[model samples]
Target: MLNRNNLYFIRRKVTNHIMLSLTFLSVVLTVLPLLLIFYYTVTKGLTSLNLDFFIAMPKPVGEAGGGMANAIVGTLILIGIGGAIGLPVGIMSGTYLAEFGNNKFGNVVRFLADVLSGIPSIVVGVVAYTIVVLPMHHFSAFAGGVSLAILMIPTITRTTEEMIRLVPHSYREAGLALGIPKWKTSLVIILRSAWKGIATGVLLAFARAAGETAPLLFTALGNRFWSTKIFQPIASLTVYIYDYAKSPFTEWNDQAWTASLILIALISLISLLFKFLTRSKY
Candidate 1:
């Protein structure tokens, strides 16, 4: 005996509840895989976690009691090299695209960036090998870094452009109205405002680069011992994980899980640190 209006209202309420439930379910589904991976990694890795694992070199085959100190340092070094080459280029390219890219050349650059982003990481590794390793006549950390930088550039460039574009046009007008030069305004007001987003994008690129193993396989070639020279092969957590995971030894298998845990932890720590450091004061 409900009125038509009451029936319509009931239907609307039911629809809203159903949609909300659906969205909640979707979120749960999206997060479940990540949670499962983390749980399994933590459970398997904790047994192998020790001070030695951070301080000692990899043990010889069929032996025990070793660490990944060299791999850890090498990973940091590679990241440094890649960031040095990639960050400035990406930020500058993105700034140009956002501010002055409403033309054919900009379109071409944007298109190229998109295409580069879609290219497989292994393909990029091969390209770097051909360009760097072949010329040098050996695999090197430098080659690995070059491949990582290439992968980083496209993501950082597009992210930078998008973050900058999100800034209000009024901000630009205000800076210009104050008699600030266009370049200075873009550098100071615009960039400062968009820095948090840009930093997040940079961190994302770093995380992706850190996780890449195939590129390093073709470039760095995975050293077993310590090596700091840029021109020499270097170790990395991902490579260690790859090698250990494929080994027949149980110790190596355990270490692989530990290395995976370490890689995930490292990326998470860096991301949190970057976010904290780049948080807006105002």
Candidate 2:
């Protein structure tokens, strides 16, 4: 008995309600896993947290009260080296792809990036082993950084390309109209306009690299003692966690939990810092 307009309105409302419910469900699915990970990590890891965990070296097996200070420092060094290698290369490569991507060579580069992005992390580790580790005659932090940088490149390149492409073409024209060179306009106006998004990509690449362990295994090789040399084996949070979690020692297991917490905290802090940086400019 309803009029056609009334029927159409009712059907539209029902469709919208259904769509809204689905969207909410998808959001919950995405968020619930993250929330669970945070809860589990915090609860289990808090019991083992202590000052020595940050300042002191790991005690000899069967000893208690050692910290992951060396591991923490080693991670920082690896990330720094990797970032230095990857960030600029990724940015430049991405700019090229975005600006000059409508060509055969660009298609090849895009194909390569896509392939690398899908490659396994362990496969990258093996490749690094064959190349960097073998040439050096031993595992080293330098090789580990190289491996991580390789993993980061495709991702950063893609993200940077996408972010740069998102900048309005009008900006480019405006800069050109002002007598700016194409390269200068791209760097000064276009890049500045999209800086926040590009930074987010860099941070994301950093985070992804930080979480890898297999690549380090074939390269850094895990040092138990403090080693500042880039060519020397070094500890990282993920590698340290791997070693500790496998040990029969209850104390080592507890320390592993603490290390897990610390790694999570460090990554979270980095993410928050970048988030603030992005928002501050906007």
Least well predicted 10-residue stretch by lDDT in candidate 2: 273-282
Model 2 per-residue lDDT at 215: 93
Query: On residues 89-127, what C-alpha lDDT tens digit does candidate 2 reach at each position?
Result: 998898889887889999999999999999999999999
Identify the runs in model 2 with alpha carbons over 4 angstroms from their true place: 1-26
Clashing residue pairs, backbone N/CA/C < 3 A, model 2: none
The Cα error of candidate 2 at residue 192, in Å, is: 1.3
Q: In candidate 1, what are the lDDT values of residues 1-282, reduced to their tens digit? A: 999999999999999999999999999999999999999999999879999999999999888889899999999988888999899999999999999898999999999999999899999999999999999999999999999999999999999999999999999999999999988998899999998899988999999999999999999988888899999999999999999999999999999999999999999999999989997688
| lDDT score for residue 219 of model 2 | 91
* lDDT scores of the candidates, listed in order: 0.94, 0.91
